[model samples]
Structures are given as C-alpha cells and as structure tokens.
Target chain A: MTDTAIEAADLTLAYGRRREPALRGCSFRLATGRVCALVGPNGAGKSTLLALAAGLLRPTSGRLAVLGTTPAAARPRVAYVAQDKPLHPGLSVAETLRLGAELNAGSWDAALAAQVAADGELDPGARVRSLSGGQRTRLALALALGKRAELLLLDEPMADLDPLARNRLMGTLMAEAAEHGTTVVMSSHIIGELADACDHLLLVSGGRVRLGGGIDDLVHAHALVTGTGRVADLARHTVVESRATGRGLTALIRTDGPVDPAWDVEEPSLEELLLAHLRAPDAPALITPGTTPTRAVAA
Target chain B: MVEYRIDRRSGVATYLQIVQQTRQALRLGLLEPGDKLPTAREVVEATAVNPNTVLKAYRELEREGLVEARRGLGTFVRRSLGGAPADTPLHGELLEWATRARAAGLDREDTAALFAAVLEEKFPQPHAAPEQAVPQPQPPPERTLPQPQSVPHGTTTEGDPA
Candidate 1:
C-alpha cells in the first residue's frame, strides 16, 4: 500500500492566462486508508483541487502525487467522481458500471456487478435519467468502487444525498477503506456529518488550507466559554469571539493552553468552528485578488 | 437473531438509533459471533428506513469490531461481547473528550455533572406507573404569583416591589 494517497506542494491552478488562480500555494497530504473531508464554501476551488489531484487539470506550479505516482501517470489506479453525475442518460446502471470497468482496464464480472448494484439499492434496468438524485449519486459511487481504484477522489459526493443515503454511502466507503485499503478524499459541505464520518479534516478558504488535522485535535484546541463576568477583562490568553450574548456574555474562545479557572468552558461543535472562519473579515479577501468580496466560505 | 426496536418519534438521528439498537443486541446476546447480518438493502426494506441508516449502523459496528464485511458476500457478526479485545473508535473518542475536559480545567465533579445532564437529555428516566396506568392529576393551584419586573443593571431592588 502507498504511504500517502495524495501529496501536493505549493500547488497553483488556473483556467485561463488572465484568469486568477483557482488554487494558490495549496499544500497537504492525505494518508492512505484514511477518509479525509475537504470542506470550503462555494467556488473555494474544491472542485479544482480534486481535478488537479485526479490529473484532469495540471497545476500551474508545485507538485502533486496520487498513490505514489503522479496523477497523470497513475490514471488507472486513480478514479475521479466529478461533481456532476457523469452518467450517460441512455445507459442503464449496469452499462455504466461496465463502462467504468472497461475504462479502468479491469474485468467486469456480471454477478459481482449485480451484487454491488443490489447492495447500492439501484435497479440494474433503471436509466440514468430516470433515477433520483440520491440514486444517481449511489450509482456513481458503485461505479467508482467497482473499478477497484487505489485512490478515490469524490467531489461533493454527498451533496444531493439524504441523511440516510449519506450514512449508507459513508458506511460503504468506510468498509471499502478497511477491506481494500482504498484511499478516499471526498469534499463535502455538511461539516457535522463529515465530522462524524471522517477521521481527518482539511479546512480550506481562499484557495488555501487554513487548518488541517485530526478532528479531536481541533476540538480540543478550541472551546466555548460562558460566564457572568466580563470576558475581555479576565486575560489576553483566550481569543474571544464575541462578548455580548443574551445569557450573560457567552463567548467562543480559543485557549492558548489549558483553560483558565475563571471561565466555564465547553467544546464547540465543528459547525461553530467553521462558522468562526466564515465570520472572519479576511475570508472574502482570501479567495480572489481584485474581485468584490463574494460569499464567505465558513458561513 | 438480534432484535431491534426503533422509536420513530425520537429526534435523534436514525443512524444513531440503529447504533444504540445494535449495541444493545450485542449486550443482550441476541447476536453472536459469526452470525450473518441482513444486507443493507434488506435492513432498509424490513425497517422501512433509509439504506444509509442501516449502512451507518453497520459502519459503526465495523469500527467497533462487532461486525465484519466480506467482499462480495455481506456483513457478518465478527465477535461477541467477550471476544478478542480491541480498542474501538468510540472508546478513543471518549478518551479524547476526557482529555479535552481535563485540559479545560474541569474537575471530576464538573465532568460527572455534565455527563449526568447529557445522559438525562439523551435517555431520560422512565416515569413510575400510576394505579390506573394513566398520568396522575395535578394538585389544585394555591395562589397566583405576579411576574417580576426586569431590573436595570446595578440598580437597587430593595426599595422596589416586594
């Protein structure tokens, strides 16, 4: 098994000569056999990152590796599930799986493919256009899994899935990871769901990673403290988010080390932490250079 | 042979409900080592729940070593409560939480109180049965109390209404 499924160093990507870079100086490594969630707001270059990782688009600068080999060289071992469902409307579910198997230069076992389809709760005869959004997503995942790729790059795989479907897909993905040691890097907007399913999280904003680490580590590093006393007057060790609250100045603070005894502290949820990033003033300026401030990534 | 009872009315996520049910089944010996589990689709069909709920439960079970997935076969019960030992992910999560609480300067008493509150909120105690198996009537009201007026910050309330 490869030590690292994905590694990028000082990567910069752009669409056109004059177009601003979609991603700038982004660097991170996703270890093999781990589920890593890439989270950011709309147009934060998440799709571009996946494309570069999958070798669909080459980085303008820096380096990238997928499964111990450059993405372009490891095309057979790397599978890219694009943000949009890339299914052919005229093809049936089985046909689509067959196409994936053929493209990957792998054998397509009818019985095994049927079993996977049944497991995914997809009808073999159902046309791509007739399937619901969730079904389409499942079918896409099934196709990817059937290809037996070493590294799976899923772009917004759970965007259209319902809560239950999302859970099931996560289970399937986890099983795949454990059994085959497949490396999965999936992007998602649902921070809480990702927190529960993924072990590692990469928080991206303005085409760069603001934070990347194990989920437990991030939660332990930050806390939400509520108190009756003035938070600003206590000390400068804590980074106070806000001082005004209906219930006596509840503040979400990040402690430099151990929390002080004066304030009551509780661990903030992933959503709260993500919101803090979105609420920051530099969030808009972080993305594009000259354009007007667009939607904040954290919110 | 594991039996699961789901409370659809509860606000908890369905996957969490399934996880609790599976754990209870293992504790009760309803499921044993090497027992074959219903497929995700079958569970969804039988329970009339989403396939994802069953999948999520199975994923948690796999993480806990309570279940294993056989490629091209299906999920099966791996070990019983007394089988080979391994530190499940949930245990790690609990330990992480404890460390965080400790780092936050929370004492044993504070941690216990917080845990008790969480338990009460997540799994409330059942009310005792009445003689008629129905809710008891409330006692008659003794007197009406007026709502207290809001006081300004640092304002003296001694001279106000008693």
Candidate 2:
C-alpha cells in the first residue's frame, strides 16, 4: 500500500468555453490514514477536485494520482460519493444493497453495509424514491462503507442529515478510520463540524488550493497579532489579512520567526486562518512539509 | 466504560477534555483501578471525534502513569487520583455542611461561590502541576467566615445588604 493517499500537481480542469475553469493549477498531497476536510467557498472547485481524484472527471492539464497510481487504476480501491448521490430511484433498499454486493462481489462487506443502513432505521422494503433526503444520504453512505474501499472521497456528505444522524454517521466514519486506517477526505461548508472530525485540511478557493496541511501545523504556522502599529510595521511577516481595530492594527501573519514583542501574538483558530486566506486571495500560500508532494511540479 | 461529552464551544482542546473527564471519573471513584478505558474506536464512534484525539488522550494518561496499555488487550486504569472517595466520611461531612449552608438561607449560587472560595484558598492552583506535590500550610483551628473574596463579576454580596 502506498503511503500517500492522493497527490495532485498543477492540476487544472475546465468545463466549457464560457465559464472559468473548475480547478486551475491546484496541487497538494494527502497522507494515508488521515481524516481531511476539503473546504472552500462556492465555485471554489472542491467538488471538481474530488471528481478528478475519483477518476470521474479528467483534468484539462496537470497530473493527479490516487493511491500512488492513476485514478482509473485505483478506482477499485477508492470509493467516491458524489454530491448529488445518484441512485436507482426504483430499486428497493434491499435491492440496492444486493446490487452493491454484486458490483463489489469479493470485497463487499454485507454486514457493515447493513449495519450502516440499520443505524438510520432504513426500511429494506422502501424504494429509493420514497426515502427522505437524509435517508438517501444514509443509504449512499451505506454503499460507500460496504464497498470496503481503502480511500473514501465524500463531497459534502453531511449536508442533508439531521444533527443526531450527522453525529452518528461521523462516529461511524471515525471508527472505520480507527480500525482499518482508512484515508477519508470529506468536504463540508460547516467549519465547526469539520474541526471536530478532521485532523488535516485542504482549503481550496478560486480554483486553487489556498491552504493544505495538518490542521494543527497550519494553525501554528500563522499568528494573530494585535498591536498599536501600522501595516508597515508588519513588513517582516507574510500578512494574510489585516484590519484596524479601534485601539490598534490586528493582522494574521504567516510567521517568519518569533513575532516582534511589541505586538501581542496568539495562534489563530482554524476558522480564523481559513477565513483570512479566503478573504485575501493574493496572500502567499504555505504548504507545510508533509502535505507537499514528494515530486516537484513542472512550472 | 466512561462516555465523553465533547463541548465544541468549551474553548478547551478536545483531547484535554478527554483527559480531564477521565481524571474526574477517577477522582470520584467512578473508574477504579483495573477498569478498562473505552477503546479509541468505541470513543470516536460514540463521540464523533477524530480517532487520533482519543488515542492522544489515552497516551497522555499512560505517560502520567494513570493508565497502562497491554500489548493486545485494551488500556486499563493503573491508579485512581488521590482524594476523598465518594462514600467516605469526608463526603458525608461535606454533605452535612452543604445542608447547613442551604438552611442558613444561602442560595445555590451563593453556596457554590463560598465553596469555590474555600477550595481556592486550600488548593491555590488545583491544575498548576498535577504531577508535582506542593507543600500545603495547615488551616487555623478557629474558623472564621470566608468572606468570599471579591468575586469576578462583583455580584457576590448583591442580595444581602448586611
């Protein structure tokens, strides 16, 4: 098994002639056995990136790899749950499970799939058309877990579930990672939800990866400093965002070293760091040690 | 097995919360020596937290000599935090004292404030250095009313004019 779960180098993908590219020159590496959060604003190419990694969509330019091989070759070992969660509307819940079992045959885990379905109290006789949005999500997740794939790529997996179901499903996902060392990358708009369950993060914006690394490392790499000073005073650090508070200038800086003692420095929270980068698109990006690909990208 | 309730808004790191909860359970005699801690899988499955957070907490507990992990078996409590056990005479005495305080017309908040003040005076810094023992000075025999030191919100003596 490869140590790297997913690696992309200068990956670019375009839709049609009129619209901007979905992903443009995006690159990052996700290590195995990590629960990573893919977060970005609308049209930030998060879904496009996941699709590219899943072999469902091809990039217009640049390279992408899944499990140390081409995405197509890694399909059997990877599970991708699309945002729309397409399923046969006519098939009964039981029939859907049967179909999954048939498709994945030798590697399918029937008991695990059934347990996931049962956790949601999904009825076997119910048709897919009859299930609620949350129920369909539960069923989709059941198939994903049942496949016993090594890497799970989920796009906004918790968007429809109620709070209790969200918690329960998250717990199940965490347990799977704990036991089998599965690498999971799930995208979500809720920062608090992701903060609790994810140790690594990929912050994509404007078709580019703005931040990618271990959450703790990324948070520690920058400092939130507030002091009575001007922007010129912060010339030494890479300032992501800065605003003038009533008493002084408060800024988020990717620290070069120990910040000057004149400014009171504290670590920015994950949300604050993401928001700062998202607000200032031109800030120099910092891809910490592990998240960088072993092979350098061709400019 | 002890279940952890994670408060996302608590401002406490998730792993630290786990360690604090386990230590609290030990001090209260809820988790005695030889009791097995819930596996990381079980904890993450129930709490919806990342599995690493749970493992990190357990590793910290192991380093403190509060728990031991056997090769194949799960982690077990090695020793309990030293304090007055729940069913001991000290607890009974505290209960009686609480009853007297309530009868003396102190509201729950007032009593809590008073108790916390006394605890602060005695413990000084309960969490400063759990591993290192600090020599404590004995309290005087003649008890004087602990005029609850100026409370944070400055509402300690609000209702009573006396």
Candidate 3:
C-alpha cells in the first residue's frame, strides 16, 4: 500500500474567468494513517480542495493525486462527504444505508454503520427529507464510515451536530483510525475541537497553504518571543507576525537556531501559531519536511 | 479499566493527563498488576483524542516500567504504585485535618494553598538548586502556590492531597 495519502504539486482551480481562482498554486503532501484537520476561514477554498481530492472537481492546473493515483482512479477507495450532505429525500435512513452497502458491496461495514446511526438515535424508518440537519449529518457520516474507505474527505462534518453528538461521532472517527489506520481529512471551523481529534493540520488562507504539517512539528517550528528590541533584532529568524507590547516587542518567529538569552521565548500554542499566520497571510509558508511535495514543480 | 477525563482548557498536555490519570489509578488500587489497560482504540473511542496520543501515553508508561505491552493481548500493569490507600491511617489523618480546616472557615482555595505549602516544604522539588531552595520570591499569594497540574476542577473535597 502507498504511504502517501494525498499529494498536490502546484494545484490550482478556478470557477470562472472573472473571479479569482479558488486555489492558487497550492502544494502539499499528507502521509497515510493521519487524522488531519483542514482549517481556514470562510471562502478559503477548503471545499474546493476537498472536492478536488474527492475527484469531483478537476484542478485548473498542476497535479493532484489521491492514494498514490489520480483522484478519479482512487474514487472507490476514498469517501467524500460534502457539506450539503445530498441524500435521496424519499429514501428512509435504512434504505440509504442499504444503498451505501450496495454501492460498496465488498468493503461495506454494516455493523459499524448501524452502530454509528444508532449512536445518534437516528430512526431507520425515518425518511431522509424528514430528518433534521444534524440527523442528516449523522446518516451521511454513517454511510461514509461504513464504506470502509482508506481515505475519508469530509467537509464540515460536525457543523450541524450537537455537542454530545459531535463528541460521540468524533470518538467513533478516532476509533476507526485506530483500528484501520484510516487517513481522514476533515475540514472544520472549530479549532478547539479539532485540536483534540487531529494530530496533523493544514491551515489554508488567501487561496494558499499557509501552514501544513504535523500539528506538533508546525507548532514547534516557531517561537513566541517577547523582549525589548526592535523587529530588526530578529533578523536571524523568519518573523511571521510581530506587534509592540507594553514592555517590548512580541513576535512569532520561525526559529533558525537558539534564540538569544536576552529574550524570553516560549512555544506558541496551536491556536496562537495559527492565528499569527492567519493574521499575516503573506508570512512565508511552512510545510514541514515530510509534508512537502515529493515531485519538483516548475516555479 | 481507567477512564481518562480530558480537560481541554486545563493547559496540561492531553497525553500527560492520561499518564497522570493512570498513575492516579495505580495509587488508588483501581488498577493492579496483571490488569489490562484500555486499548488505544477504546481510549480514543471514548475521549476523542488523537490515537497517537494514547499510544504515546502508553509508551511513556512502558518506559517508566509501570506497564508492559503484550504482542497480541494488551498493555498490562506491571506493578502498582506503592502508596497509602484511601483507608490508611495517614489518609484518615489528612481527611480529619481537611475537615477541621473546612470547619475553621478555610475556603477550598485557601485550604489547597496551605496544604500545597506544607507538601512543598516537606518534599522539595528534586531538581531545585541550593540557592533556589532558600525560599521562593513572593510576588503575590497566588503566584506562590504550586502550579496546578492535572487537577480536575470542582473536586477539591476528595482529599487527594496531591
């Protein structure tokens, strides 16, 4: 089996000529067996990227690979849950699961699907049109998880669920990853919740990958230092964002080596790191060593 | 089996919480030698934490020689931490002292601070240097208290004494 789950080399996509491109020359890689949190602001092309990886949208330029092959070729092995969660309105919840089973006959995991559906207390006989948004999310996730796909591409999967449901479903997702080593890529706006459930992260903004790598590695790559000095004093390191505090200037820097002892340095929390980069999108993007694309793309 | 309670806002790392809870269980006799710790899948299924975090906690336990992982079975407790259980005379004395402290109008935070001060005096941090061991610089009373570890909030009545 291929170790790389998803790899993109300078991938770009646009809806029309008038509007700006949704994804602008994006490139990154995700290793297998990772539960990665794809986080960004609204209109940040998160959905577009997930669609491209799901084989629903073709990139306007550059290469996109899923599961060591073209997205289209890996469709059967990848599960994609759109934000809308389009399901047959007339079909009952049980019928929907049956359909999923038929579509993925050999790989279908009926017990797991049923259990997930049961955990949400979704009535099997209830029609899809009559289900609430959160219930619909539960059913969609049931189908996606039951498909036993090697890679799961989910867009805002927990948006509609209540707190209890979100926690239960997230637990189920983590269990699946533990048991089968599934590579899950889920996009969500809740950074706090994602921080617990994900070991890796992708922070996309302004149609580019601003931060991509293991959450710990990316967080450790930068330091939040507060000291009495001008911004120029940090010339040796790459400063992502800096602001003047009451006592001195506090800046987040991608450390090249040991920081000077005069400065009080501390590791930035995941939230701090992401916020600093998000506030300054022009900051030099950091893709940790293994998360960088394997193939060379022409600049 | 020990169920890990994760406090996302506690500022303590998630894995360390698991490790602390396991150690707590061992000291309380809730987990004994030859007992099986919950599998990583089981822990993640309940806590929703990253599976790797569970594995990392287990590896730390293994490294400390407190637990051992069998190939096909699961992680088993190698030995329980030797400590005075809840029913011990020392525990009773502490509980009585806490009750008296409560009766004496000592609020929970005040009681915790006083207890922590005594603990720090009796058992100084092993890594502290001679100069640093003289006495902590007192800025504010709150800053003098030991930094909270994985203490679950609202459970100060348990006489944990940690």
- Which is the leading candidate under DockQ? 3
Cα lDDT for residue A13, candidate 3 = 95
Off by over 4 Å in 1: A107-112, A119-132, A229-240, A281-299, B1-162
TM per candidate, chain B: 0.49, 0.67, 0.75
Q: For candidate 3, lDDT tens digit of each residue in A107-187?
A: 999999999999989999999999999999999999999999999999999999999999999999999999999999999
Most lDDT-accurate candidate: 3
lDDT of 3 at A222: 88
Docking class of 3: acceptable
Cα lDDT tens digits for candidate 1, B1-162: 554555655645567677777766655467666777877655543454434446767887777556788998998876555321234465677688989999999999999899898867764544422232321111111122232234332222222111
Q: Residue-wise lDDT of candidate 2 within B18-117, one digit each (tens)? A: 9989989987778877899999999999999999889888987887667889988999987776555567677788899999999999999999999998
Model 3 chain A: which ten-residue window has the lowest total lDDT? A290-299
Q: Which stretches of candidate 2 lie over 4 Å from their true place?
A: A296-299, B87-162
| Cα shift from native, residue A193, model 1 (Å) | 3.0
Per-residue lDDT tens digits for candidate 1, residues A1-299, read: 45777777777888888988889987666667666778888878889999988889988887877777778888788778999978899999878877877775643334544554686688878899999887888788777777777888999988898877666666667666655666778898777666545656777777887656655455555677766767664465445365567667676655555555555666676678777765662532221121112222111
TM-score for the A chain of candidate 2: 0.97
Q: Rate the local accuracy (lDDT) of all candidates.
A: 0.66, 0.86, 0.88
Write down the TM-score of model 3's second chain: 0.75
